[model samples]
Target: MADDPSDQDGALSRRRLLASSAAAGGAVWLLRGLVRPGSAHAAPGAPPGLPAGLDVYQRAYENWAGEIRTDELWTCAPRTPQEVLDVVNWAYGAGWTVRAQGRRHGWAPLTVADGTPAATRVILLDTTAYLTAMTVDGQAADGSATVRVQTGASLESLLAFAGAGGYGVTAAPAPGDLSVGGALAVGAHGTAVPAVGETPSPGHGYGSLSNLVTELTAVVWDGGAGRYVLRTVGRAEPDCDALLTHLGRSLVTEAVLRVGADVNLRCRSYLDVPAAELFAAPGAPAGTRTLAGFVDGTGRAEAIWFAFTDKPWLKTWAVTPDRPLAARAVSGPYNYPFSDSLPEPVARLAGDLVSGAWASAPLFGQVQYLLAKVALTGDITDVLLSGTLVQDVLTGDVLTHLLLDGLRSDLWGASRNLLEYVRPTTLRETANGYAVLVRRADLQWVVSRFADFYRTLLAQYAARSEYPVNGQVEIRVTGLEDPSVCGVPGARPPLLSALRPRPDRPDVDTAVWIDILSLPATPALPRFYRDVEQFLLGLDGERATVRVEWSKGWAYTDTAAWSDQDVLTGAIPDSHRAGGGPGWDEAVAVLGRLDPHHVLSSPFLDALLS
Candidate 1:
């Protein structure tokens, strides 16, 4: 929000833009909907639904990627829980499949139940359109209180809303455009309690936003019931636990979050920390643990590590900086001046043409942004990356030795399209704590099949035992948010673990959460997924579990599970799963209840039930 003309640190200017044939703040109202043609699985009775006028081309767009120009489901938004059930019921009744979509944020067709033989006769329920309402936690008239937001609401809007009401989210990943529900659905997080004041180092005692979800309203299609039913559960739920972690079978409609008081961070964006020394660096331009004067007030600092480069640089920013330090001349880094309420992508891109043209070098997290910014501006995020074939990735940690080193083999290139979706799952420490924003490239069966960027990077680095190309990558830095899933990870009483079937086995009750995501749009997308997966499996020899991020990684990564049953739960596996119990048993019974006619089923959903 500064108007400094001398803002050489990459501050965007009007004249600089016109000189570069760029437009700043240009708004584009491109059609945003999953225009895929299909129907949700409804019961035997099909209400005379809307006419068959719905078609992909009819709407001019389809959200195969996620909401961000980042992913292909961008066109599909969130719908209310009721809307979710309606779509499910209608699809069931019409003898079509129903794929629950959240922000179309994921790349797998798991959410797509339309136009393809797998789910062509299915209904796609957009989830981003869902809205959220806030109030003081515990009805506090004076003191701070928790805020409940809808699953489909955008995180940017939620933050702004909370800020306006004298509050701020407790934590956030990066990227202002992501939604709360989408983040949690994929286990979004940030580097926790990073070194800030003097010494820049990493620490322990971290967690995921999944641990914050106090409650959630998930739409589990009860196939046997033949009627849509709503079930509300506590943080420690039974049947709802698995759904809380992964968006596989049960579709989430609402996420009741535990919010904190309004607070701002004093961010001092600094950089040049190469990725190679990211973990071992004693200190750089801005080490996360203690940038010292970098952050003033009680606010904390966070770091960004890029993947493509040779050294990991730090694009360090503070939650709040000291007044005296803030008064001094700030770093003239090229930064994105995001608006309080970021305009629609098109308008923002037009404006960026002018504002973004100031610099195109992405070395310090600048170039790829312009490209993505332009891609989004052109409304062809999916169109641009639509020329690949699909393949699988392994995300589960402690993965079988058989799959280890598979990437080093020759099976990779043989796949026409080899992609791996990457996500920053867990952040026990703020410096390393991270979350991933889902992208649109994952929607196409062809694109996600490629190797992940981070994976390749990790594989190359594994030999060296050091990665130095991470700090300040443009693709994911600007976007950050706390887990919006609203489901608390490792919460007391473990609601997420409560609703499992565990009568015969105690292990099913205590499970871990892994996220599902689509591949990035680039060739290195698969590598990103692999590196993160290996990181989760402690492949780095660090002996630490890599935190699972929602949009960060998916089934193919080694950070999460890929077993047929594990895939069903939709989270990383090897730990305990939802156990068997009356509550869980009852919940399973309802899947039958919701689809008595057995008309509602998909490889994605059936995988879960089987």
Candidate 2:
């Protein structure tokens, strides 16, 4: 399994060249191919009678991990919010559907379904091309500030802008490439909950990023005008609740989000923690380094356990006004080069798995684990262990080179640098995601139960000589939505957000997010995910509830995801409808009112949202 020296050298050179070019080019990479031609009528696949003066072209559609793809369809970029409204009106009149296309960094079919024909009456509105505009407004007396930003702006750009003004969000999704509108559409979140001694900061929320939205402007139907119009709604408005996390059922043009003062953070990575000890039952030995213990100490942590591995890579981030001596100071995001660019040997193993080497799942898992261990800690003692496939892949030369590159075990920097690590260059894997709402005391219990069931289920699959998972299990915890943090009176939680608090279970203040990832089209993955979903659905019984992470896979059948009728029509909607709160039903009704013509929706959303 050892990689050829020449191939390794070439791969390293290519990665270095890419990194250097990216640094030099800056945001040019995101803005490439965004130019609008003078004549849209001449463009291929351009439908007749489309809105004039818009950039129109034929663009193929692909989601994150390449799970859903389609041939070239009619696409356009609107330079202004009024143009967006015009496009929606045109689509509504022409019997066509308009799906807002961002960076396409999502797993769900909310934007466009797979196998959509080229001639289908669906036009993609490319938001990132022309709608990216952001400006910081005045600061408030409560140490909070607001930023008015268009939906097409990337999260990295937004944070960088905020950071320049000494403000930042408490948490955000790891990938910096995600568009702000796309992130809000899915109610994206990061791992954080209030620690034992931590105090709430004004304008800072530990829930999904959507909770920070104080006001948003979206295209909604105007009954009196009988057309779609750009309407601004405040958080206090009941209609704003549905627009906060519309799940692609509505198109948001721009938003005003509340933010707080910036804080530096030190992120420490640990690769030696045994999964058994870290996820042990609640009443374990007093000194055991458990997941809950880390959360109690820092309030922000994430556990990434590669499939079939014994130890998980646990990362804990603590707020540190000043950098510690042992921590390396980083000035920017995506600090983990080892993860952003895979080593040649690891890439080869992944290729082998994709080429149908099913039995290599165990070896793949171990290689991934060892790769992280060496990359983060510079310790290759595990790789030196005799008679293992991992040793063969992570040869002494690879370990030496990785160690020479330097360790990334501890890093301290601005919150944005430490919080955002994922890059578009990382391995593309499909995932199944969920959020389990439970009391803080039951966090350990939920982790233990999931770990036990996952281990058992994986073993059974292996025993039957079927390997489904090739990636890792990611676990993160966050606080439920608390609208007061937005500093808007009478504001309510996002009705469709998975982190929405259950009114009846006031004590269930935390949400434990669990995601299982694997290569796309892996045999038997659907069945494996089905089992996991069923287990989680009933994990805590009356004490907790499970909700689907909107952007990832869910509602599984033995053959595919989003196919289970019961989970889609019953379990999912019921989770929000429970406690008789104004959630699922209300959100659905409002979304219907906003887009009564359904110009912004696709067939998948029509079925799921209905």
Best by TM-score: 2
Candidate 2 local accuracy as lDDT? 0.88
- Candidate 2, 549-584: lDDT as tens digits: 999999999999999999999999999987778999
Q: On residues 1-610, what C-alpha lDDT tens digit does candidate 1 reach at each position? A: 3443523634323233222222222212233232243434222222246223222211212232322221122122333455556556665566665544444433333344333332145544455444554443443443344567776666665666655555544345454445566666545544333322432211111134545567777655443665655667666555444445553455566666554544333333333333333333223346343222222322233333333333322233333323333222222211232211122332333233324321211222332222223221322242234332100111122122212322111111100011111221210010111222211111111111112344355447545543323223322211122222233453332222212223343322111222322212222334444554444444222111122333432444332223223323543322123232333234345455544444445664465444
Candidate 2, poorest ten consecutive residues by summed lDDT = 25-34
Clashes of each: 219, 0
The alpha-carbon deviation from the true structure for residue 398 of candidate 1, after best TM-score superposition, in angstroms, is 48
Q: Locate the minimum summed-lDDT window of 10 residues in model 1.
A: 409-418
lDDT of each: 0.36, 0.88
Best by lDDT: 2
lDDT of 2 at 458: 100
In model 2, pairs of residues that clash are none
